[model samples]
Target: MIARLVARTFGLSIAVTVAALVVAYLYGGPAALFVCAILAILEISLSFDNAVMNATVLQRMNAFWQKMFLTVGVLIAVFGMRVLFPLVIVWAVAGLAPAAALDLALNPPAVETADQPSYQTIMVQAHPQIAALGGMFLLLIFLNYAFDEDRRVWGRFVEHWLARLGRVRHAAIIVALAVLLICAQIVDPAHRSSVLTSGVIGILLYLSIQGLTAMFDDDELPDTLDPAVPDPSSTRPAERDRPAHLPVGGKAAFMLFLYLEMLDASFSFDGVIGAFAITSDPILIALGLGFIGAMFVRSITVFLVRAGTLTEYRYLENGAHWAIGALAAVLLVSLKVEVNEVISGLVGVVFIVAAMISSIRANRADARAATQTAAGVSGP
Candidate 1:
C-alpha cells in the first residue's frame, strides 16, 4: 500500500538527494554532505504542517492541477522561492544591483565587511519584513478557519466565542489588521516601514486571491476531481463522495496555483534563513532545500491526498490550521524578539500529533457506537 502511494515521489526524492549530496560531497567534502543532510531533514520536519495545509487545498483541485502542483509547483518552490526570492529580497532590502546581489550570495565575505555585509547578514536584517508578510497571510487563514461557523472540531469555550466574533463582517481582516498594527508598534524603528508595507501587501494579496476565486466561479469552468473517486473498489465512505461545492478551474486554477506557490514562499521564509545557521554556502543550501526538502514535501502532499489520510483523520486539518496560527504569532513576534526555529517547528508537531491521537480515539468510538446500535436493533 505504501509503495503504491509513494512510489513516484519516493523515487524522485531519492534521485535528487543522491545527486545533490554527491555534489555537496564533492564541493565541500564530508562537512558539506552532513550539512545538506541535516538541512533536508530539518526542512521536512519543520514543514510537516505545511504538507498537511497543502493537502487541504490540493484535494480541492482536479487531477490535472494536482500534476501541475507536483511539477510546476515544485519548480517554483525550488527556484522561485528558495533560490531567486532570497536574492531579490537582499537586493531590495540592501539596495544592491542584481549582479551585486548574486555576487553577495555566490561569494559571501568571510566577515560582515562594512562596505558589503555577507548575504546571511542581509537576510537576518530582512527577517522582520519577511515575517510580517508571511505572518499576515497565514494569520488570516487561521482566523478565517477558526471563525468559520461550520468548524466542528476542537470545540472549547474559546471556539464558541471566536465563532460569535466571526459573525461580524470581515472579522478575519479586522483582526489581522489590528494584529499587524500591533506588530508595527513594537518592532524596531528600522523595520517599521518595511514590516508595515509587507504586511499590508500580504493582506491585499490574500484578498485579491479570494476575490478572483469568487469572480471566476462558473459552471463552465473545470470542476475539481476527487483524487480518491477514481478507485471504484475503494470502500471508505469518506472517499466515496466529493465535496458538495466542487472547486472551479480556468482562471481560478491559475490563481490557486499562484496562491499555493505564495503559500510555499511564506513557509520557506524561515527555512531559507534558518539554513544559514548551519552553513552560509549558497550552493549547499540550495541542494538541501530546493532539491531535497522541497521535493519530499510535494511528494508527501501527493501521498496524503491519494491515501485519503485527511478524510480518515477528522481533526488533522484543524491541528494544521492551529499550527499555522501559532506560526503566524511566532513570525509576528519575531519582528521584535528572536524566536527559535526549533520551537516554532515543535509547536506544529505537537498540535498535529495530538490531533492524530484524538482522531484515532474518535474513530474507535464511532466504531463501538455503530456496533452497539446494530446489536441493539437485532436483540429487539
Candidate 2:
C-alpha cells in the first residue's frame, strides 16, 4: 500500500511538472523550450540531495502542507526566484523603477542586444552585497550540516532572554523589518517604504514558512549507524520502524517550506547571474530557466519517490548534506568575490557523486555478506 501510494505521488508530480513546461513552450518559442530543458537538467544535477533534504521533513507534513508545497512552492520557484528576483535586485541596486529595470532587461542597446542587461547584470551590480549576504547564508548552512554542535545564528543572549519572554519569533521578525527599513533609508529615504516593505516581507515570508516545516522533520543519522554496517538495507528498515521524533507538524511544515525556498534562493544567486552570461534576455532566461528548472525539481521529487531512492541510498543524504555545505561555502565566497555558477555547480556535483559511489559500494558489500551468511546457515 505504501509503495503504491509513493508511486502515485511521484507520477502525479512528474505529470504536473511536465504540463507546466508544455504551457511554457506554448507561450514561448522553441528556443525557450530548449533553454528550459537545459535549466531543468542543471537544477536536477545540482539538487539531487535537495529532495532527500525535503523528504526528511515533507513526509511529516499533513496532506494540505504537502499540496501547498507543490503548488505554492512552484509559483515561488518560477516567479519569485527565477523570473522576478533578478529584477528586484536590479531595481534595488540600480535605483531604477521596476518597469525601467524590466525595460533594461527586455531591450539592451542594439549593439548590446546580443548581450542585454539580464539577471547577470543585476547580480554584477549587486555582486558586492550579494557576495556578502550569500557568503554568510552559505556559511551558516555549512556549519549546521558539517559540525557536531547545534548551530544558531542568533546570539545566545537574544535567544535565551527574548525567547524566554515568549517573543523571540516576534522580536526576530521586528529586527528583520528594522534592518530592511534602515537599508531603504540609506539607499533612498523617500522611497524606502516601497522597496523596504517588499524586501522584508519577501524574506520573512519564506523564512517563516521553512521554520514551520523544520519543526516536524526528525530524520538524522543515529550515532551508531556506522559506515562499517555490512547491510545498508538493514539500516533503512530499522530507520523506518522507528517513529519520527522531530518537530514536524503543520506549522513546522510551513516553516520548512519557507526555509527550503530561502535555500533555493541562495542557490539561485549564481544561476541567476550565470543565465545572463549565456543571454541577456530576461524573458528568455525566465521562460527558459524558470519553467525548466521548476519542472526538473518536480520530476526529481517524483523520481525519488518512485525509486524510493531516499530510503535505498543512505549515502545520498550524506552527499546532499555535503553539497549543502559546499554551497554554503560558495555562498560565503560569493559575498566577497564573484563565483561562477559553473564552478558552484561542479562543486556540488562532485560531492554528491562521490557520496553516491560510496553508497553503492557499501550496498554491494552488504549484499555479499548476506549471501555468505545464507550459505553458512544452509551448510549447518
Candidate 3:
C-alpha cells in the first residue's frame, strides 16, 4: 500500500527531477547541478505548508479539477510565473522593451553598476511590490482562518479572543487594511504609493476569487458529519445522488483552479527572489525552482490528499494557516528589512511540527476517553 501510494504520488516528480538534473548539468556542469539540487530541497522545505494549504482546497475539488491542477496548473506555474512573469516585471519596472527584458534575464551582467544592474539586482529591486501583493493576500488567508468562528481553539490562549472577533462584521477586512496601511508607512516614501496599490490589488484579487467561488460553489454542507442520516433540506436532486466532493466542475472548478494558481504564485514570490541569492542566472533558477521544486510540491499535495492526512491529523490545516501568517509577516517585514530565507522557512516548520505533536496528544486523550466510556458501558 505504501509503495503504491509513493509510486502514484511521486512517480512523475521523480521522473521529471532526473531529466531536469541532466539538463542542469549540460547547462552549467556540476556546480550548477549542485545548486539545482539545493534549490529543489529548499523549495520543498519552504513549500510543505503550501502543499497542505493546497490540499485543503484541492480535496473539495473533483478528480478532474485535481488532475487539472497537477498538469495544467503546474505548467502555468513553471512557464507563466516562473519563466515569463519575472521578465514582464523587469520590463515594466525598468522601462525596458520586451526583447531587452528577455535579453537582460538570459544574459545578465556579471558585475553591477548604476547603469547596468543584473537580473538579480532588478528582481531584488522589485521585491517590495511582490511582497506587498503576495503578503497581503496570504495575510488575509491567515486572518480569515484565525477569526473563523467554527474553528476549534486547540493551539493558543489568544484563539479564544480571535474566535470572538469573528463575530464582528468584516473583522478580517478591517485588520487586513490596517496591516496594509502600516506596511505602507514603513516602506520608503517613493515606493509607498506603489506598495499601497499592490496591497489593495492583492485584497481585491482575493475578494474577486472568493466571490467567484461562492457564486458557482455548491452550497450544501458535506454529508460526512452523519452520512447515514441525510439532511432532507439538501438541495441536491433526489435522482442525482453524488459524492459531495465530486461534480465540482464548470465555473466553480475554474475559480478553484485560478485560486490554486494564485496561491502557488504568492508562495513562489519570495522563493523566487531568494533563489537569486543562490545564483543570479534566471534560467538556472527557473530550472531548479520551477521544474523540480514545483513538481514535488504538486506531488506532495496529491500525497496529502490521497493519504487523507489532513483529516487524520486534526491540526494540520490550522498549522499551515498559522505558518502562512508567519510567512505574511516575514514578507511584509522583508519589504523594508533583510529577512533570512532560512528563518522564514524555519518558522513554518516549527508551527507545523508543534501542531503535529499537539494533535498526537489530543488523539491519545480521545482514545483513552473512548476506551473508558466503552469499558463502563459494558460493565468491565
lDDT of 1 at 63: 78
The C-alpha local distance difference test score for the whole of candidate 3 amounts to 0.84
Total clashes for model 1: 0
Q: CA lDDT, every prediction? A: 0.83, 0.59, 0.84
Off by over 4 Å in 1: 218-243
lDDT of 3 by residue, 1-380 (tens): 97899998899999999998999999999998999988888888889889999999998787888899989998998888777878888887888876888788778787879899877788888888999999999998899889886555655467768978989999999999999999999999988999999999999999899888978885533434323322222333431243334447678888989999999899988788888788877677788889999999899998999898886677788789999999999999997899988888899999888878877887787789889999999994
| Predicted candidate 1, C-alpha RMSD | 4.3
Among all candidates shown, the one with the greatest lDDT: 3
Each candidate structure's TM-score, on Cα atoms with residue i matched to residue i, is 0.92, 0.67, 0.91
How should the candidates be ordered by lDDT, best one leading?
3, 1, 2
Residue 94, candidate 1: C-alpha displacement in angstroms: 1.9
Write model 1 residue lDDT over 127-224, tens digit each, in one string. Answer: 88889999999998889888876555364566668877889999999999999999999988887998999999989988888778667655345565
Model 1 local distance difference test score: 0.83
